[model samples]
Target: MSTHRALRATVVAVAFGATGLLGAGVASAHVTADIYGSEPQKGGSGAIVLRVPNEEADAGTTKVEIDFKPEYALSSVRYKPVPGWTAEVTKTQLPAPVKNGKNLDVTNPVTKIVFTAQPGSGIAKGDAEYQDFEITASTLPSTVDELVLPAIQTYDNGQVVSWDQVSTGGAEPEHPAPTVKLAAASAGGDDHAAMASGSGESGSGGSSGTDDTARWLGGAGLIVGALGLGVGGGAVLRSRKAGKSNA
Candidate 1:
């Protein structure tokens, strides 16, 4: 009877623990932004992917609106085509002219991007399913180290979630905005242009050197693994010999 009681108690504890973990996972899930490939240097072009997850149990996400801050003054924005979804970009005139990457003054800049899903095509509910929306910028702002994009998610059930809280280096907010950090500008020129030009002969030589170093490290690892196996096998043989002699 005691054994059965203990088994039942263990099962109950496990069930409660699992429920708590599942709840934590759902609560922690939020929209996020990530850069494609290497981080874009300041004053260069780059691509960004926004990942949106549907968290509602009975509703599907049908629309997403991303708001761009005016201070960055992004002038050129383009989005990748997504099947079953329509994308729209809106530009607003700035209060004052701001210098872009080309050092030209811009009076108008892209202010928002909104994506709407077609019928039966939005992010499906359950299992926290997600969709990625990609966008490219021709010129990233040269001054800021990070770009914070606030977003709004609309559900088919008329539910809305606003992710607009700004982080101040303290505890994370409940609905923190998505952000992309930018690398420092290269001294020579735009990083993207350099990559396009193959970074000249010196860059090619550096890449070759790195590849050789990697090959040498791989060979050294294999040799070390073989030596370890040999030592282990010898120890096992010695133990067997001593045991047979004692018998």
Candidate 2:
């Protein structure tokens, strides 16, 4: 092949390979608790999104139950309404109220949350359609590095999958619970100023920036792959035309 032809073929191969990999990644992206706040204050409220995707080739997801360990010591919890699903919050009496300062008191907070897809409201079994269950978990307890939310995913066919496996620190569990790494909530760490100023939108933007980085990377990979295929196809066409002219 000519120099130009070789370059085109290389681009085609790499781009297609990249595109394939990214596509696979999207398919395999499992249920996750995407924490918006990078460093959830030990005693502050934080929002998290539980992204649930239907991995079933044919079955639609119908219900999802997330259990918060009694040990986590969360003070308050609130669930956002999903258009096609009904959310239920279950609160249990804490051993004691989580008192912050002299005025703020959070008691009898949420211990469990369940979302049931109303008829066809479940995550549609498809290439990219999924559901996000957003919730606000408040007054995160201190002295923890990560928060693991064990989730049970149910499909329309009555099949149940548990994301309950945990690891001390070694080989990853086959079914890993959705977890969030906690950062120190200090003056420079947590968005204290942002929280106080009630400029939640800016703080939210900053928080989501970190969570979305990985997704952004995957999307970029897909775009690059497509471009590669285009370049390669052009190169092959050019090479064939040159050969015909020389013949």
Tens digits of per-residue lDDT for model 1, 1-247: 4544565555556555545533432333788887534677788765677889988999999999999876667777777668889899888997788887667687888889999999989999874588888776646788888888999999999999999898999999999999988888888654442221121112212222343356556556555545565565567667877999999
Residues 10-54 of candidate 2: C-alpha lDDT, one tens digit per residue: 776766676675554233467788754255666556667788888
Clashing pairs in 1: none
RMSD of candidate 2 to true structure, Å? 6.5
* Superposed Cα deviation of residue 147, candidate 2 (Å): 0.6
Q: Find the candidate with the highest lDDT and give its number.
A: 1
- The regions of model 1 sitting more than 4 angstroms off are 1-28, 191-247
Clashing pairs in 2: none
The C-alpha local distance difference test score for the whole of candidate 2 amounts to 0.69
